[model samples]
Target: MSEEKDLFQIKSCGGRKEADEIKKLLEQNDISAEVKEREKDFVVLVPNSEDIVNEALVIITSQEVYDEFYAGE
Candidate 1:
């Protein structure tokens, strides 16, 4: 198994669709994202390099906030 340091988790999701939603969001925004399956949860990952992790996290957080605020719409 690759060490956690190799890839940083942007979000931990309950299911494959949940993980894929944000993964697609990141790719649509031109940021690379990866999905890793854990025993209990799925996680979205980005390279550990500082070059993109911050931006990825920002997008991830922003998308999540947007979804939360507008979910009922």
Candidate 2:
């Protein structure tokens, strides 16, 4: 038997504000996203890969989505 492992890491630093902001932005654009991982000093948003549908979730997404996240900032 083999265990599962993530291909990449979505790092989030600074604070939760960035993570929350990113989520709201991606959702608004209709780009499915989620918080994949989180740490005391940072948060991680790993995008959904075709390999794993309900497994590896997403954090931040496309350029448009990213733009929206920092729309005001």
Candidate 3:
């Protein structure tokens, strides 16, 4: 099988829980996101959405965005 390509990344986060929150947010918004869980850290990716992803690049790495993710939780 060919390796998959990701369109976005969670460049910075305080912890895995935070990253997971972001992942959920992306999904709730109907945006596909992925999480790579590591021993010490995690990474998140925005795969794609039926609607074009806008402001994603601007908000993906912001704590404020992550806050919204948790607020939804």
Candidate 4:
């Protein structure tokens, strides 16, 4: 018998746009990701593995992207 694994939340965004952007970024880098809406926050989920999600988070939170995304804000 096969067992299904639960998705783990890697990050949370304030809205759909932000969540979709993050999802696209991860997908572009060959990592599978999804956005789940919980109340007003959008959560980024991946398979139940820490290494992949941790790497994704590092890329997403890097200084270059952070500056580009939030420079004017």
lDDT tens per residue, model 1, 2-73: 666788888899999999998999899887788999999999998788877889888878877998999978
Candidate 2, superposed: residue stretches over 4 Å from native:
1-11, 50-73
Worst 10 residues of 3 by lDDT: 1-10
Q: Write the per-residue lDDT of candidate 4 for residues 1-73, one digit (tens) a residue.
A: 0222567787889999988988888888887888889997998887677788788878788834778889878
The residue-by-residue lDDT of candidate 2 on 1-73, one tens digit each, is: 0212432344465776776666566567554445444446545444445533333333334544667879969
Q: What's every prediction's RMSD, in angstroms?
A: 2.5, 6.7, 5.6, 3.8
- TM for candidate 2 is 0.42
Most accurate candidate by TM-score: 1
Q: How far is candidate 3 from the true structure (C-alpha RMSD, Å)?
A: 5.6
Q: Global lDDT for candidate 4?
A: 0.79
Clashing pairs in 3: none
Compared with the true structure, all predictions reach lDDT values of: 0.86, 0.49, 0.62, 0.79
Displacement of the residue 51 alpha carbon in candidate 2, Å: 12
Compare candidates 2 and 4 on TM-score and give the better one. 4
21-46, model 3: which lDDT tens digit per residue? 87787677666667777667787766
TM-score of 3: 0.55
